[model samples]
Target: MLSKNLLSEIKEKSDLLNSLKPLSPENQAKLDKKFRLEFNFNSNHLEGNTLTYGETELLLIFDQTEGTHDYREYQEMQAHDVALRMIQEEAAETERPLLENFIRDLNAKILVKPFWKDAITADGQDTRKQIIPGEYKKTPNSVRLSNGEIFSYSAPGDVQKEMAELVAWFNENNGTEDPVLLAALLHYRFVRIHPFDDGNGRTARLLMNYVFAKNNLPLVIIKSAAKKDYLAALNRADTGDLSTFVEYIGNQLLWSLDLSIKAAKGEDIDEDDDLDKELELLKQELNQVPNEFEQEKTYSDVANVMENSIIPLFLELNSKIDKIKDLFVKAECNIQISHVKPNGYHDQLFFTSDDFLFGSSFKAYEIQAAIINFNCTALKKTIRHKDINYTLQIDFDGYNYRISNKFKNEELIILPYKTFLSKHNIDSIVKVVVSYVIDEIKSATNLNI
Candidate 1:
């Protein structure tokens, strides 16, 4: 029988559990597998056992009846092992910098391990190596997963810097705001960075759960079965869109919370609440508050909106231009705008003017204009006033194609018929670029228009 203290502790945990809804049997099974794996990994390490990839994965198999054939994948084994070790090390650390150092160290090791020999040529020549700040020259490779898709193994330099900044920011704001949302944002941002040439997905998932563990929440696993949805969530995040990923992960977390709550109560789990409704309600509440006070908006407010919001928009826009440039051969177009020289100027039109707009507003307008210009230039040809279809030659297919249009903007340059058809087929790519621009614009200005 459980002791009085154990029962009391269980009751205390139950009270916390009451705050969550129940989860489905499928979700419950997933949560159970993840918890078991995490538990076994931690327990083994605590008992002074060095864990391997195979062992880590076997721990995830709650029942052996399904057959162990699928667990034969070596990469999966390696990924699980590294992920568990990182989680264990993070859980063991009490200090922030130390925790970060451990994570970074793990990231470096995972990146170089599988691709080490391949990272160098047979002649002993170094291949494409990455320069991590403290880790020095490390080999980063693009490894193809079992799904035939390739992913990089090293954290990009910019992503590493952003992660460092985010870690610092978290240390400063950890207790002041809601930890769940903070953790979500951290997870979203980390995955968006896609750091590491190889284990980025697994590492990101671990880091996300690490944030949850820091907040005393159960670990959330994005199972291989949910890999498609997971990738979709991440792709949405890549374009600075968080709604899908947030909804997806939040649901997973709520499911875990429910199961843990049920286990605490020593009762058979029934049903979990739909977190989407609760999340929507929370978002609505957040939207009602002034941007200056909202936690997500705090960085924007403190950083003068321009540096925090506008510059990122510009960078996002630049990335879009690069994408559009890639679709067309011999269609080299450089998009740039003159920086607005600050002179004490104020008026509605002046505020709207390219010359007078400053800070975030300037950044927003410039990017918005650049995107519109690029799209229009890619589509339209000659501008016509009144009823005339003005004729003009626009570059397409390594040849200038004669085209006409009824619009007045010279900024519009229409590609030829064949070129337009070919480009339209890649509409998803275009949507990604446009969505990236839109997300950045919204982030920078919060301009509903």
Candidate 2:
């Protein structure tokens, strides 16, 4: 039915029965919203609907339309979304079997009102075909590809038996086949029949997901982006390469399942990651995007904080440190910020003070140690206040923080600036790193204001 490894991976990751068993009804409904919007937008978009995702969201969520689309486009987007939701409701009705009537209802929901559409007839003459919503085609239908070949569906005379056969095959295999295969084959078979006059593709997709939903699996989308591969995969099935389409559907199932998992975990799902280029997707998968873009943005944010805020901070503290340059007491000291290392180098949040003398009883290094120890104490107190789990390692080379009690395979570096900016409203980086160090120094060195 499908690749054993791929199926195994999906089963392992999905664990749908166990994973979904514990979720509350509200959580389930919340999860459905994400699928409904993306599925509706991408599905309609593939069929040449001109609504942007934002516009679709606007119309669906707020009843406020945004785009200059034909009113049919708006109605279809709303209708398509409703069909998806209705299928979910139908799937919930235990007694409702997959049937021609159910499929037509979905198609009718897609068009809302029937109208005539223009098409090229078999003899290559332009003609207007009467479209009765949810009804079978009275005349035959076929697509003329770019190369001028016609890919035809069942003849008008044959659609009835073919559709009956399609429904029976789906119902017979409904609980018997691997669900991903069942869904993909159901779609391929139905599309081959071109059973409805206008909403064949949309109905195929809605039926595809209904198969998954009935099996307690999460729904998957054919991103409009995967259009090329989506069509190619279907064409492959036409020539009897069903595995390619099965894998395509399998991949989409995996993709949606992963997205659902991360979404459930409350992680940010990137919109650009949803589909592939050329945008024809049977909801196949996109590879993992490099974190390079996000990491670069983060680096930029950190750099902005340093340049605009952190540098001036150090210069101000250095000004105060500049004043102490004149006084010569018993011991001279320098304040240096470097990595908490045995003998290493660093990024130069780097500050060092000119020699400043205290009294006879003070050793320079001892005073520095006292300052470091006090800073450590204040850091620990602050960490406790924030409820972070880490320890400060203070030494002559300077201080570093690490997760002392937590363990992970890869090191999790805590860039002080990243932590600073990520918390937002980090007005002063110098206030954080410098204040703790300098305040402790002044107190421990017994320096008066």
Q: What do the candidate models score in CA lDDT, each in turn? A: 0.43, 0.60
TM-scores for every predicted model: 0.40, 0.59
- Whole-model lDDT, model 1: 0.43
- In terms of TM-score, how similar is model 1 to the real structure? 0.40
Q: Which one wins on TM-score?
A: 2
Clashes of each: 14, 11
lDDT of 1 at 230: 70
Report the lDDT tens digits of candidate 2 across residue range 1-449: 68889989999877854564555555555666668778998899777675656456667876875424468989999999889888888888766788788898899899999788766666544467788899998897877554546667789999889899888888788777888998999999998888777888899999999988888788889988687889999989989999999999999998888777766665554456434211211101111122233332233443343333333333444554344333212112222233223243332222233222121111111211111111122222222222111212222111212111122121111233233222111212222333334444333332211
Model 1 alpha-carbon drift over 4 Å, by segment: 1-15, 18-34, 38-82, 85-89, 92-99, 108-112, 116-160, 268-449
